[model samples]
Target chain A: MKRKITLKQIAKELDVSISTVSKALRNSVEISEDTRLKVQAFAKLYNYRPNNIALSLKNRKSNTIGIIIPEIVHHFFSKVITGIELVANKRGYNVIVGLSNESFDKEVINMQMLANGSIDGFILSIAKETLQQQDYHHFKETINQGMPIVMFDRVINEIPCDKVIVDDVRGSRKAVEKLINNGCKTIGIITTKDYVSVGKLRTQGYLEALEDHKIEAESSLILKVDDKLLSENHLESLENEISNLFETNPKIDGIFAVNELYAVTAIKVARKFGLEIPKSLQVISFTDGVLSKHSMPSLTTVSQHGQKIGEKAADLLINRLEQEEAIEEGEEVFETVVIETELIERESTK
Target chain B: MKRKITLKQIAKELDVSISTVSKALRNSVEISEDTRLKVQAFAKLYNYRPNNIALSLKNRKSNTIGIIIPEIVHHFFSKVITGIELVANKRGYNVIVGLSNESFDKEVINMQMLANGSIDGFILSIAKETLQQQDYHHFKETINQGMPIVMFDRVINEIPCDKVIVDDVRGSRKAVEKLINNGCKTIGIITTKDYVSVGKLRTQGYLEALEDHKIEAESSLILKVDDKLLSENHLESLENEISNLFETNPKIDGIFAVNELYAVTAIKVARKFGLEIPKSLQVISFTDGVLSKHSMPSLTTVSQHGQKIGEKAADLLINRLEQEEAIEEGEEVFETVVIETELIERESTK
Candidate 1:
């Protein structure tokens, strides 16, 4: 069987990164001269074809939209896809999905595979590793090839493309303000590390709300948990971390978490400490997922309306595709539509 | 600005189902002669080309696997994808996903789009509508065209392909027997209608377990919920239905639900009735999802090992694809690999 060489294979054979091989193949300036030359020679030997999006887009229409999500077992992404499908079907286009699994190389690989004449445009969330590495070159290369992309949720500010995002900071601020108004004195926050854009923005909202109320911010009350420890299957670490937070901040009267799982887990841990919800500690989380709605005592939270974001993203991509000819002859304008978030009050709050 | 006409469009343009249009295109006698001729003529007029899978296979190897799932927002399906991706990545094959959204026409259209030289073979779970319609010409046609397929979870037995499934009957019987062993006198069951094969099998297991224990089965105790009434966002109907079950049978001491949502909801309703879990009432559900773990009082449920099913399905498909040359030269063998299920005890069961 004569299998075509892929960037992943080349990287494995030459003991380099997929990004390095991709850059070297494109003759990027960032790659070292020796590595680039070696990479080029190996690719040539294996007869590697990079699945050129530009050349493939020169003729024919697939009329399919490709969406790359960071993870598959996520509620928000699933809702977004449901929204995208409802609109795409009405607009006479089909949708396909690729998973990046939060890896930088996988993200690049999936984009290349989907862009290889399989789809007309893309709707994607930035992968965690790509954001951490601050690598936007693959995205720029695909757009340069004349394929339209609409990014949603986890988007980059510098990317010159249409984006649909929820007002993360404002939503978080609303949750914090609600807690303050309910007579919460010492509020604590459970959030992700600063690298994740949404988590960082949400943390900023908490800080801003505290400053507005003239409450002294305490570092001891803030718990920045590792995202890896937050998987639904193994939540012992998450529970232990929240337990430690309660142990250290005995005066904490309110809690704001970046997601529902953390908020629900905190409630479970709080029960061990014999603190009654709403009366002793009020809790709010971001993303109105199933956990918040189904958990005992429920939870007050922020609703991102993921489906609306997905619908808007599909419309933007399809509109851009239809206007490609006219846009080629005129100046291009990209829009960022912010989907407003709402706060839902439940038993966790006063 | 030209676009290829799809079966979905042909069906819409004419007043026929997508399945009818598909059959008419392939000259299946099942379609009425008048409808067949009209469909063929319309397809011809619009330059619609049914993706020729075998013809594409002769010239190239895309080395990509296409997986069509019934729904994306499901935990079991998501876990399966994670498992498939893990092994597929290790084995050097990439995966692309198409969603059917539980519709028959969308499943046909997605298969056509993916089969159009984008992927080498398919791994899919049948859509709900397709199962109800009982029109499996699409799978047969694809197989006849020299394309291999691997089915998982909700699969049909007649399809000559590799399959991965859990022992639904055995798993359900185990859950019921556990409840019985805990000294529950009168037991009830919550399941889907007979149209869904897994639900039917689980119900059968419940009945068999009752029969083996010399307990008379009561028709009043069986609550077959409409699948449409079970969406997470709108739980009022589901709650009402479960509440009715409890009201009708005040002496019910045990319950076995086919899925986690129903089991968790039953517990919630049981709480409303002031019945304590594991004492006055015991509950068990199938499919160990986050709800089973996170719900107050948790749940004792059947674990299908969805990731394991996915891994097995991928291995089967890749093995068959790699051995196509040998398979064609010699005898072909199809497999149905059954993944075993285990019961995880939690707060819901004593």
Candidate 2:
């Protein structure tokens, strides 16, 4: 029922450096007998067990980092990988990528496979299934075993580790505000179900923007698309759902989509209904990916700068891996770095 | 310089199983004295030196397969990875992906890094720079060191190994023939330079299609885009080049692009010239990726089935890895699998 205590926490409470605590716990002759006994007693009281994997860290140095992502076909995840590799390779570390296909079991299997002395650490994004199930034992177990993990983009707060994320709420708010600035009297927003962290944050931002503009948020104009619609087989149904939204709300003059697919789909459906883009229905979307750039009347978008996020995540992970010198153990500090997003203006907006 | 002989070749020449030849060469007591002498003499005659890494293979049983790719952001490569992971995970193997970023040095480094007891074998796509430089020493050296390799998509025939490829020439011919069947005259084909094997084959297919139709291939209508044009900073120049082709050959009614980017770019340029898709200017491209599907007119394309290629490549590599019962060394056979392509009709063409 209680949170697991770490070596850093024990060291901090004892007013000792992490290495001194480690040496004391290991009963190194370099540490005095009195200090060793005290450290061991403290460790036992807190049910602290030395990480199994950490004990072998000194013997195996692969100089390689493993990255496990939810999906390989995604534009944002790929960019993050490119960024991670650029930094990792330059720092004399090779990167090994594993795809979980958005499954919780696959995610756990990949982490375990990589952790078998093949990689020094990991940089990962949580899978949707894992998030939906609210299960993070795999992440906690890996960290407990002394392998550092730096999560990015799709991360859960339940795990105690470093994270790098974009300001999704702020980015979405800016997009909605831009639509309002374009003199749109009525607006619509399309997003994924609330289980997706980024989608939920973006949806909240949409509501906040409406409130700020004194425009009552219309529930009818907000569509929470089923994730299944994003797959290749259900594209027609996806179009139908978006089409139904437009047919039901004829006065919705502007749109904000949490991701590129929805934004492009809305454009296609709007054009089908004989609506002219920019002139009749301006739109803004998240993720400045290939779709946003290549879509006709190229989309105006909130660019997540995925590569930068990758770079930050890799830096956080590699720094932890190379921190041979034990920390001051001041509450075992963890960082959650937020990379700012940029609104890229294009032909889809006035 | 003479080519180094492999264990399979030695085994074949000695008329023994590959395992027997291996055991004999290692001076195992299980092999009869006569057989050991015969295998050893045959190996020495062919100047066979046991691969350094192969000797250590027995000590390391990391059930992970390493894959090195040219670019991770590419749609084709990503799909290939997805397929590979699906098959590998199912077969109780884990895939570790390494990106070469199309650099020859990075390719060599990634291979070397993985070969140091981190993985059982490698599945790789050769980097463009490696092919352009015509330096395959790294591949030859790796193979000589007794590690099995399975190359996919962009591969070199000089390396004696298993390969999985689409029928590029056939696929291209089909796409071009389809455009010709629609009564397109003065067709333009946008492609990469001849150094890229896929583009070169596709371009040859276009030429063959024109020859079959009794239409002399117009050199002016064929645009061999510089590889640099694909980068973000030079995309405008790429567009300009395509526009110039249209400007000079106003009567060109169809376009067969070797890849999705060129096909989509052509559509954008055609629209700029007030040409309507399908009705006035038909387009067909290779690679049924996101861009092809989501483009305004939805491109008609030759589906390469990248995932299938990945699956086949993984099967080939894993089989080699698990071939503990060495073959009856009659001959070391290698297979080049050609996965068929299908032309999917969409709005870009009639």
Candidate 3:
């Protein structure tokens, strides 16, 4: 069976704006008879039934914004939602969240479901799977259909939309530099495999920090954990991997983890080895979440300020959605906003 | 400024189903001529222009479910979302989430926005503020309008809908009994005020455990902490309140906290007073979340199995949505499913 065509395809095929195609479909007097007939003939030829026409045709504002994230049980993503809600609610827009669970198919499905008139616009973070697959057609299709999308956190450069991101490279560098300044001779870094955008950037930051300090980076000191470590079933292996890092590198006095879980796990393993924190093994991780604040000795962390990123994303999407002229003209101007991260000191760091 | 008349209000006034009113307004042959004319006359009297008709008239399935929770930056809630997404995606349904931020107004607004043709059904936890106000009209209105709602976790008995909850009282009682079995003489309880259903039930469990053990319950040992303590702004005050409980009850050898935050906070305070966990002060709290597992000494807790609750709630809501026979008959069969909780033993308790 052939895939159902959309107004976007018809508009592109007929060499007319989406709004003009929409008007012609409704036989609006605003469009000339010749243009209306041409658009209608094209739509008919393609068997375009306008499956989601009700979403666009509804005059009453849904006044709700949809946010799609890769995961819900994540510290940074949750904080971003909180921030987005704060701004969206204040501006008379309700926010709905969709979790992709790090699957590319789920991400595309969520966008399609939300874009079908359930929400006025979308604010989202790309899933790890989506980024790795490098398939951005879903995003392009949604944007082409005249729905505003603002991406945050795990965003890709290929998508031409407003984005909010923390400088992962700089944030990681600052965290690693802190460990260096605390008089560490050797430092180990725990991070995800390079397929993840943030993990790659954070690893880069670690490498840059070591080079800046004139310390030769040891490949063995960097442990690239598999993404499966995120699931509960893989936690034991994650702990084992970190333990091997400690056991293999007995001289490693400092560690930097890309996220909170890895950092906390490192501390747990360090304690098992009878190493005292701060005094014996100073550690710093990214994301100042509940685990960071309440862990034993509490964790020294690089706070990505997730809420600020959320607020910035909301502002961009809402601004775009409310601009009638931009919608009419189908403006393609996009922006990438970077929020600053702060390094937090705690008992885990001297 | 007259209040806009909704299909719900018209259905109530006309003593007909919302579907009937919707059909008559659209001049559908599904309604008899006499009934249609009568409905049309009533609608005209109320100046109903059917503002959200597009939402109701569209026969196509949205294939989406909406979930509203009090907060997102919470371990329990996030886990619940994970479970819901797992079940929802497997069932070919997409999930959308809204955060109430524990506010009554936001909760009502979110429901209204989602109900306006955005989602097929809802699985939600009540906002703290909504429970405090005892206002459940939005819930009643949605149910009346032929929408299915499945309440979970922070649910109330007032609403007649499907519910998924853990036996909070029994869970708490088991935790307290474990503390008593560890040979504690005086046990202090840290919980929220009585308005919160979970807190009240957990407190009752604490009392029942003491009563079952033939130990007299001391009113002074019970510290009803303000709910605001959950936020970072009031953490210092929360710490002070728990400290006072410790200072005032010098004989207190065990503690039972209703939530993970309170339990971890108690551990922090107990350490400040030079008290060793499991040896000097045995402790157990409800909800085995991230903080409990990674906290110093690793807390013993009542595991609520949040994922199970989410899965059950989603099943209930989705089942109701897909049952065309039930919708046609306006069936009101409601089931309250109680999930069991487990007592997890850790180093914080003997």
Candidate 1 iRMSD in angstroms: 9.7
Model 1's CAPRI class is incorrect
TM-scores for every predicted model: 0.80, 0.83, 0.81
Ranking by DockQ: 3, 2, 1
Q: Candidate 2: which docking quality band?
A: incorrect
What is candidate 3's lDDT per residue for A102-209, written digit by digit as tens?
Answer: 888988877766665557889988888878788889898777666778988777887788999999999999999999999998999999988788899999999999
Deviation (Å) of A155 in candidate 3: 2.1
Q: Taking the tens digit of each residue's C-alpha lDDT, what string does model 2 give over B129-248?
A: 888899999887667556678999888898988999999999999999999999998899999888888989999999999999999999999999888324766778889999999999
Error of 3 at B322 (Å): 3.4
Give the runs in model 1 whose Cα sits over 4 Å from its true position: A1-61, A228-234, B1-61, B229-234, B329-331
What is the alpha-carbon lDDT for the whole of candidate 3? 0.85
DockQ of each: 0.11, 0.16, 0.18
Candidate 3 lDDT at B306 equals: 89
**Candidate 1 chain A: minimum summed lDDT over ten consecutive residues — where?**
A50-59
lDDT tens digits, residues B1-350, model 3?
12356788889988999999999999999999998999999988865654422543455445678899999898899999888888887897777778888989989978876665567788999988888889999898777666779999888898889999999999999999999989999999999988888999999999999999999998999999887435666888988999999899988899999988899889899989989898999999999898888777889999999899999998888887778434566546799999999999999998
Tell me the tens digit of each residue's lDDT in model 2 across A70-160: 9889899999999998889778787777888888898988887776556778999988888899999989777765678999988888789
Candidate 3 displacement at residue A202 in angstroms:
1.2
Which pairs clash in the backbone of model 2?
A: none
List of chain B TM-scores, one per candidate:
0.82, 0.82, 0.82
